[model samples]
Target chain A: MSNNPIGNVWIYIEQDGGAIAPVSLELVCKARELARELKVRTEGVVLGSEIPESLIATLHAYGCDHVFVADDAALKLFSPVPYQKVIVGLAEAHRPNIFLFGATVVGRSLAPRVASRLQAGLTADCTALRIDEFEDKASKRVLKNKLMQIRPAFGGNIIATIVNSWQDPQMVTVREGVMALAEPEEGRKGTVTPVPVALAPEDTAVTIVERFKQPSEVNLKGAQIIVSGGYGVGSKENFRLVYELAETLGAAVGASRAAVDAGWIDHDHQVGQTGVTVRPRCYIACGISGSVQHRAGMSESAKIIAINSDANAPIFSIADYGIVGDLNVVLPKMIRAYRARV
Target chain B: MSLSILVFAKQVPDTANITGQAMKEDGTVNRAALPAIFNPEDLNALELALELRERYGGKVAVCTMGPPAAANILRRALYMGADETILLTDRRFAGADTLATSYALACAARKYGSCDLILCGRQAIDGDTAQVGPQLAEKLDLPQITYVESVEWVRKGRIRAKAQIDGGYEIIEAPTPILLTVLASSNAPRPVGAKRLMQYKKAVTRSELSARHGGRDYEDANLLAAEEEGLRARGLWIYEWGVDDLEADARHFGLAGSPTKVKQIESVVLTGSGTKDVPPTDEGIRDLVHELIEDHILS
Candidate 1:
């Protein structure tokens, strides 16, 4: 171990259009757990322009010991090249044993680049993490610095345990909702470490000509309730029932990869190994025969309700509640009852 | 000017679905039980390289880092119009992760002298680790364009490519002698040509033929005679390369050089049960919806 003491476990807070992504705070909770086990502090790494001071404190309430702000004009939008260079430089200068990033589009692109530059081992889309302890008899030393990074491998059929044996800092990207959220605290206080990054014109290889945010139709990752459709919904038109129920309950509409491939829904709303992994309070699946790929994404949902015509649908296996019925008929009545209740 | 494109491919065990008593008692994959095939995406990458070679008029070299069994893919590469093939097979290259594999491949690539372009699949299905291409670029000090959805232009010195981004795609320009990790959307690999398959059917590697004979007992005279007759008959002959041929760093070639290790494997079986059949009636729907809302499944 280097004489320079490791300061704090930092969580790179992610935000899109001024709203904090739920995964950012989810990472804070996970980092908090890790810090407790290691007897270290937890910090939040936030980068952007015009971020409110109040938002910095919000991170503290979520268990951040210090909020490191790297506000800059170039970071106003998400771009891999500049973001990676800055984070990698910071990580190299101030080494952190374990860096956690959300397994979003941006994180996936940036993590690998940073990992390559730092020559660190990075496990992607990890579902779990823990610290292990061991003693080296020959050296008369206690080897207590092992971070076991766990993620689903072989198309989600097997869970692989990956370790960064050489590098001082081990990195892993976690999918949203894999860990529980911490209770919010009031009047939390933490120091803010302001770091300055200089951006050059040549630093960014690809440029975004325009930024378009389509009228956000229910961000499924942040949705408290979700109504998802699957292949068993049968036809594209049958998806109307899923949307109707979602509309009635004010829930976001999600779909299995099969439905997305069938073009019944867009890829953004897909929930599976290749799609978004959601951990909403409630997730209702209509006509989805759950495969390991699909389950890998949403099996962690707080409450799962599967509605399938088949009695032996795999979705029923993990569902908190199972409804054996044709989704076409079951969805309509559920929508009506939800409307009536409201 | 003709383009010489080099494509890197791997033969991975088909891990699409694991079942039966195929998995070993130690929880490791039983390679013998699993059918090995040319990785689908790598085939796609090879197809793209072949298409470029055809359009621009140049030679194609296909290479792989595996055991002698990997010669199957090299022969198929020849059937697909690759001018030459190289197999970087050595007992030292076993159980390599993406990092160590890239190191060995980069060494072999350097020995291939200089090439105009190199192409590889974004990731292998078995490992699903998309690190080799980028890591190779780092080692070779070449410009890398990953997630390449399509190639707009491949000129003499510069190449224009489009990479898939989150919302859409970004078109970027990089100088030649660059590396690209082809996406699945690039193009479908063409089936083997009947003529080429028939012509190269007898092609064998030195190791393969030696193994067939239980040793290298066949006299050099007999082998030379067979090669001459086979070439005259169907243009078929073996291509061989020893470790010294590539001049790779012996220490950095395989498992011993690899830093990553698989500690344990666990099979997580997810099981649950729920409501299965609902009547197609108004009241039946009402009850279902009520339960969903009460359970916060709909709200």
Candidate 2:
């Protein structure tokens, strides 16, 4: 057996303007489970400008045994250079057994850089993570402290389980909203370690010129209900029915690749293999001929409602409620009924 | 000054047709069942590089690391407008994960001398790791901007790029000698130019020709070398390099250098208990909404 003792599990707490990103907290919850399996403590690594003490306390309540804070103005905006250098510095100082990040644009960019710097293996866009033991077929040796990183591969057609047994930090970036959030214990207390960030002027190569959010951008991860359209939506003008129904339900509007490819909707609203994966409470598919690629993204929702003209659409197989009709006729009446009820 | 750019692309198995022995019993990919195609996002990266060359007056060098068949993408890059193409092929480079892949790619990049910028697709659809570009940037000690949607401008040793974040977009300004991993939404790749396609349709790497002439032990080695020189003179040669050419340590290549291992693969099928059929009538729609709300499926 290798004499290397596994260290603490680390969570990269991504925050904007001091408030923690929801996905970061979710990762903290997942870290807690992994910590139990590895017999180690879970630590949250926060790198930002002026992270509040209250936020650190909240992290403690969420199951982190400790919070490592590197508050610096240089980290105010996420730059791959500085963020990566500082994170790598911290990792080099305090070795972590495992590190997990939210698979956001920032996380996805930073994790790989850190992994490479440390010569570690990283798995991205993982949907599920767990710790398991495995016995090698040839060596007959049992491998311990293996993080089973499960993700959809080969265009979401198969689920692949990857393991980084030879690396020090089993690193991964998980998709947002895919993991269950742990209940925060208000009074739980943990240590906060303040690490000094060493940044060189040269590391600040990429400077943010402008930043803004688009009003039309759909936040499907946070949406409790998603009203989605597919190829059967026909034209860009017909997509308004999806928006109107979404407005009545106070939900987000999503689309399949066909509608997006046809210019009926923006790529940001696309839901499928090459797009965003959502696990909302209810997923409403309007005129969607559900391909396996599209279904992979929404099949995790608590409830699914498929509306299509053809009764044989593949979406009906996994949907909780299947409705056969033309969305143009059935959608308007449902919107009117909901609006009138409101 | 015009820029010198190197773009990394991969030819991955098209997963859209995955079926029938997609995974081997040992938990590795079954490559035989799947047809290979250039990774979709890499085409977007290539488009960006070609656009950069058209506007800034630079050369775009395309490279891929795989078997001899991977040269197919280098030819496609040529047909699309790449100025130079290289194939990094070696049997020792098989079974490499992202860590080893980035290492070997970094070696090949260094051997190509220097570049003002490096471009790569955000991720390959097969592994879907999205780790190569960032990892390569680290090995090369270059700043990387990922999820790039467009390049706003490039001048005086700096490049302004527009990239996508979770909620919206951020325009970032970085110095030259940086790396950018482009997203699929960046731009529509142009189809192969007819004239260029005709010129490069026969472009093949030296090793590819060697395989065609019998085996590595062909009796006409000097004759094959002369033919290769003629091909190079016509600007139709695809540079091929193996582990020996790059001087890469065998211990740091292929399965030996890879840290991660695939433990298992399971074909996933989304199945529910059973779906309830709702009528197409207005009353049925209303009842459905009511039922959804009662079950907390809707607010």
Top of the candidates by lDDT: 2
Task: Please write out the lDDT profile of model 1 over residues A1-342, one tens digit for every residue.
Answer: 124355357677887656677778989989999988877778778877778888887898989887778888788776656777688778877788778888765666566666767767677677778988534333455557567887777643467777666555677777666667879787888788787888766565444543434443548888888899988898899998898878877789999977876678887888876677888898988888776667878988888878888887668788877778888777777776767876
Model 2 Cα lDDT, one tens digit per residue, B51-74? 998999889999999988899999
How far out, in Å, is residue A182 in model 2?
A: 2.3
lDDT (C-alpha) at residue A163 in model 1: 69
> Which pairs clash in the backbone of model 2?
none
TM-score of 2: 0.89
Model 2, span A189-284: residue lDDT tens: 999889888888899868999998644456887789999999888899999999999998999999997788677888778886556779888899
Candidate 1: regions farther than 4 A off: A1-25, A41-89, A134-142, A180-218, A229-251, A258-265, A286-293, A307-314, A323-342, B15-32, B217-248, B270-287, B293-296
What digit string (tens of lDDT, one per residue) describes model 1 on residues B261-289?
Answer: 56566765655535345455787667766
Docking band of candidate 2: medium
Model 2 lDDT at residue B146: 91
Task: Return the lDDT, model 1, position B11.
Answer: 89
Candidate number achieving the greatest DockQ relative to the actual structure = 2
